[model samples]
Target: MSAFDDNPFAESAGVNPFNDPAVTQVTNSTVESVDQYNPFPATNLASQTTPASSSPYQPAVLQPSSEPTPQATATAAQANLLRQQEELERKAAELDRREQELQGRSSTGKENNWPPLPKSFPIKPCFYQDFSEEIPTEYQRVCKMMYYLWMFNCVTLFLNMLACLAYFTTSSTYGVDFGLSILWLILFAPCSFLCWYRPVYKAFKTDSSFSFFFFFFVFFCQVVIFIIQAVGIPRWGNSGWIAAFSVIKLSKAVCAIMFIVAILFTICAVMSIILLKMVHGMYRRTGASFHKAQQEFSQGIFTNKTFQSAAAGAASSAAQGAFQANN
Candidate 1:
């Protein structure tokens, strides 16, 4: 009655995909002949009435398709990705190593270019250096010298006052002679104060020809004053309590000692001038013009003296005569 009742494997695909074989046919009479000689007997239906046919409704199992090929494709792609990543990492590592090598070579090249200083580097004249842009140290030195010079001058001045007092006391000089003495005091006191102060102040403010000019001018006056104070100026009442004062002046020895001190300070002042000239000459050789030369004359000395002397000499004949003529 049913189509499957005749053939059991009608809907199933054939064993081969390309070609199907003919189904084998078995007649009912042949089935009965095979059944008549069966060795096992069927169960009684009355005893199994509570259950349906024991055969499961599950479909027949199909042959498993080959799957190893797809799995191999996926595994191959995964392996290739990992290998590419490792190759990239290796290239990065190589690049890093090359960079380190280049850095090492660069440092080594620098050492080779500028060799290390020997343990015993000989001392050469410092005048032959390359000082392009700097403040001159001579300015500082001169300023300090000026300070000490002023202090020493002031000390002598104070001693001069004490000597004057002694002379007045010994000679009974009519109550300290404040008339002409006051005039001298008023004139010299203010003038000397400005001589040192004005120049030093200008030394800090301006770096021009006028500044140097004023400095030299005022300092020359101070030197002249020192000379006058040293040898002894007659009728100037500069004798103090020393030789020019009363014969029996108090503490004449002490006044003489003060005079010696004035001489020492004058020597120091002379030394300061000599050194100032040398520093100025050295500074001018660096191709600096008047303004710059004046500025750096005390501060920077970045050149060889021979060239400096030539350049400075060429600028001013008097300067050259003073500095190079000594050579």
Candidate 2:
């Protein structure tokens, strides 16, 4: 102490505390203790969570691409999707049934087998027809027959005029004959013209079965009467049957000409019968039978490409709207 006391620093402490090798270790321990004992939550948390050599917050590793958590959510969503799909399918089936019923009802009396009837129009009353397709072909066939009948009657009128001209021009002898024949031609010309227009008009305006029967009846009887009159018979359709036998004496040439005219009229009558058969066939093909109409309606308009597309589009839009509403 006598030697060391010679210097004041030696008395204070033989060395500087900062220069001591153990001082750094002591300082570090103090810092750690201070952090652990911190009143601040952040400092306490950092001290408790961190390792000596590591950061306070742990860094997560990269996850595998095939994470199963999302799949679990997806599976639950798929179940919901399946339930929605079944509901949509049920609605679609119901819609299809309704459409079939509407189509069937539109065409046939089988409407009773359909769904409930529709109510008032959704839009304005005058906006749309809400119309349906249901035209019976029998009526159309009748119109077509009337058209054909008119055409044929006009053609027959032309032929009748030709016969009259031919009879006058081709005759050999004419004393009082031409004058008598002239009077006969003048009188009957306008009357015979009625055969062309009247029958066609009757067929068009009136579809009475009795009228058709009467036409066939009266016209055929008139033909026989006219034939007797051509032979210069005093009374037609009478007990004077043999009187018409004198047609043989009517200049064999004229007799032959008249017979040819009768043959032409016969051809026209046959043509009308053929046309009647044709129209009847077309009518039958138009599903005139109730069962046939129902079957055709079931498959025809509903299955039409335009209608199918419209139905599909409507269904899609409706489903989309429902999904949006639910969401």
Query: Which stretches of candidate 1 lie above 4 Å from their native place?
Result: 1-138, 172-186, 239-327
- As a whole number from 0 to 100, the lDDT of residue 150 in candidate 1 is 57
What's each prediction's TM-score?
0.37, 0.25
RMSD of each: 28.3, 21.0
Candidate 2's residue-wise lDDT over 131-245, tens digit each? 1232233444554554455455445444444444444454433223334434444554444334522442333333333333334554554455444433433222111223223
Query: lDDT of all the models against the reference?
Result: 0.51, 0.48
Across 170-239, the per-residue lDDT of candidate 1 in tens digits comes to 5455234323334444566556556654454444334444455566667677666666555444334443
